[model samples]
Target: MSHQPDERQLSLNAFLHDTGHHEASWRHPESGAERIGDIAWFQDIARKVEAAKLDAVFLADGPAWWGTGHRPSNNFEPITLLTALATVTERIGLISTASTTFYEPFNLARLFASLDRISGGRAGWNIVTTFSEDAAYNFGLDGVPSHEERYARAQDFIDVVTKLWDSWEDDALVVDRESGDYVDTSKVHAIDHVGPYLKVRGPFSAPRTPQGRPVYVQAGSSNEGRAFAARNAEAIFTAHQTIEDARAFYDDIKSKARALGRNPDHVKVRPGISPFIADTTAEAEELSQYFNRLTVPAYGLTQLEKMAGTSLRHLELDERVPVEVFGGAGNVLDNNRSRRQVVANIVERDRPTLRELLHRLAGGRGHNVVAGTPVQVADTIQEWFEGGAADGFNVMPPLYPQLLDAFTGQVVPILQDRGLFRTEYAGTTLREHYGLPRPDSQYADEPALAVGT
Candidate 1:
C-alpha cells in the first residue's frame, strides 16, 4: 500500500445523450440532431472531453424503448459505442450502464473485461437493477420483480461477476516458450458461488484486468439503493435538486459506508447537474427558457405521469401543479421510491406551474439545473465540491457538443484556475484518475473453492 498527501480534485464525467439532457434540445439550432447516427460525431465529442481532461465520459442504456414520441430517444448500446469511442480517445475513462436484472454475470464480466483490455484499463460499470415493467416484458416476465427481490439478485450478480473477474491472478500469464508453458496453472482458481438468485462456477478464461475490476458504480438513491451502494459501489450517481438534500444524502452514504467497515472516502457521491451557460446570468436564463419553450406539452405531461406514477391528464398545463397530484411517490416518509420526493420538494419550495415544473425537470430529470455564466457555474460547482455536499458532479449538458463545449471551454478553465479540477491528465487508467488504488485479485492467498463434490 502507498500513501500520498491529500489534495482533493473534482472528478467530472460527461453524460452523453442523443442531443443533450434537455427534452427539446434537438430543436435547438446548435444541436447536431442529424448527426445522432454518425459515429464520427460521437467520436469527436469523446475527443473533446478527453482534450478537456475530464475524468471520464459516460453512456446510459436501457433495454426497452423510452415510450415517448416527442424526443429523440434513439440510442446505441453503450458498450458498442464506447468501444468505438475507446479507439479515438486515450485518457478519458469510458463508463457504460448495464442492468443486473437482464444480463448474466459471466457475459457481462467478459464484455467489460474485454473493454478494459481494449482500452488499456479505462473501464467502469454503472450497475443498475431494472424496475421498468416495460423492460420486464422484453425478458418474458409478466412484470417487474419486487424491489427487494431485484436488489437481492443484484447482490448475487455482483458477487459472481467479481469472483469471475478475480479468478485469474494478475501474474498467471507467463509466456515461457522454451518450457512450452503459457500460464502458471497453480495461480488460477475457480470461484464456485452459490446463492438464492444466482450460481456460478468458474475459472475465468481471461486474465486479471488492469484495474482488477471495473469501478463499481450505482445510480439509485432509494433506501435499499443506499445500502447496496455502501456494501458494493465505489461511485454513486445520484439526483438531488437542492444542496441541503444533496448534503444530507452525502452524509448518510458516508456514515453508512463507515459503519459497514469501509473507507468513507472510497464511496464517491456525485449528484447530476445540468447547466445552461452563457456570457451572463440573464442570457443563460433565456437560453434555458428557449430550450424549455421548445418542449411539447404532451411529451412533458407523459414524462410527469411516469415519474409521479399516476395519471395527470386532468390537470391544466398552465396552472400550478397541485401538491396532492403527487399521490404515488409514497409521501415524504414513503422511503423515496422514485423522483416523487424530488418533485415534491420542488413543489413545496417553489410552487412552480405545471409547465414550469415540466421545464425544470426537462433539463435534468430531478437533477439540479443551473443557468449562469462561466464563473457563476464554476462557483456553484466549487461551493458543492468544498461544502461537504458532493465529491464531484455528473455534468449533464442540456445540449450536446455546444453546451459540452461551453462547459469544457468556459467552465472547466475557471474550475482549473481555481484549483478545483484537473488541468491535465495525470493517470492512464480510470482507477488512477479517480484516486483509487488498484485492487489485488481475491484469490491472492486462498486456494480455489471446491464445492458440490
Candidate 2:
C-alpha cells in the first residue's frame, strides 16, 4: 500500500559489465572488447548512461576469477572504477558491489565514505555475501563458510559499518580560522561496538557524508537474502525471467519491508533486462540469433554447473536439463538459491534442452531477455513497470557501445515519449534519484569522546 499509484516514474540503472552482459559479447564483431579494462571506455559508457537520465551506473564484481574460459570476465574493481567514473559525471549515481565475507567493516565503511565525498553524495553500496569457493581460497580460507554463517557475519558487518559511519555527527566539522578551531571535537562521538563477528572501535576516520550513508543496494533473492534486504536495502537488483515471477518477488519484498516497519516505497525492485533492439522485429530476432550462435556451449555448461552446484559436463547438449541433477533445491534453505531458482524456472516453464538453455541464458544471466524493435522493447518495459513487476530495470546491453547506443538512442526516446521515463535528471544525489531520504547521524545525541582518551 505504501507504493502509491500516483508515483510511477521508472527507475533505471545501467549495469556495466565488461563488453556487455552476453557471455560471448567480446567475440562479437561490433563490441569494444579489446578496451574492456580501459577507464576511458567505462567513462564513455557512463556518460552515455547519464545522458539518458538513468538513475545510476552499477558495476558487478567478485574477488576471484569468474571461470577459466573464453568468456570475458569482469576486470576492474568496482568501487575504485566507479569512483573514477564519478569524477567525470555530475548527476548519475555510482554503485559498486563489495562482499561482506571478504572485507572488514571499518575499511569498507571508509571506502564508501570516500566515494560518497568524491561523487558529491551520489554513492551506493551493493552488499554481497559472496558464494565462491575460489574467493575463500583467495582470502586464505580452506573452504567457503555455510550460507547461514555468511549471512550472520553480514548482519554483524553491516551493524559495525553503520555505527562507524555515524561516528562523526553532521555539526562536528566547524572550520573557523577566526576561532583557530578546525572542528567541533565536542560533537564527535565514539561508537565502541563489540559484536560476535567483529569489534570496531571508533571515532571513525571519516566525517559525516552528504547523504549520511551510501544508498544500500541488495541483489540477493534467497529467503535470508530477502529478509536482509527487507530490513536494510533501499533498492534491490533481482533476476526473474517472467512477469509472474517478477510480480511475486516485487510484492513479497515490499510486504516484508512493510511488516518490518519500513516503508515499502523505500524499497525499489528493479530486475535486470537485456534487450536486442533494431529497426524491425525481424532484424532484432536476427541480432539475438547472432549472439546466441556465438555462445560457447562449454562455457554455458560450466556456468550452469556453478549455478546448480553440480557437475553437468557429462550431460549431452541435445538432452533436456534433468531436474534431478539439482538434487531438489526447490525447498532447500541453503543452496545456490538464486541460480537454482533460475534453473528451476527454466525447467518448469519451457523444459529447455541444454543447448537451448545456454542460448536462453546467454543474454543476462538469469534476468529477462527480450528481442524486438525499439517500440516493442519500450512496450515490454512499460508493461512490467505498470504491471507491478518492476519499479524499473537494470538496462544491460548485450554488446557495449553499439547495443547501448541503440537502447539510448532508440528505445529510450520511446520510453520518454510515452512518459514512462525521465528526459532529464531531477536530482543530484543518488538517494534523491531513488526517492530515498538522507539519514541523520545515529550518534547525534551522544556525548563526544575523543580518540585514545
Clashes of 1: 0
On residues 1-453, what C-alpha lDDT tens digit does candidate 2 reach at each position?
013334568998999998999998999987888898789999999999998899999988889887667877777888889999999999999999999999988889989999999999999999999999999999999978888889889999998999889888898888999999887888777788898889878878868888999999999999889889999899999998888888988998999999999999999999999999988999999999999999888888888888877888777889898877766664323435876787777876687898988888888888899999988988889889999999989999999989989999998888887777778887899999999999888888777776758
All-Cα superposition RMSD per candidate? 3.2, 2.5
What candidate 2 gets wrong by more than 4 Å, as runs, is: 1-6, 328-336
Residue 418's lDDT within candidate 1 is 76
lDDT of 1 by residue, 344-411 (tens): 78887788888889988899988999999998899898888888999999999999989999999999
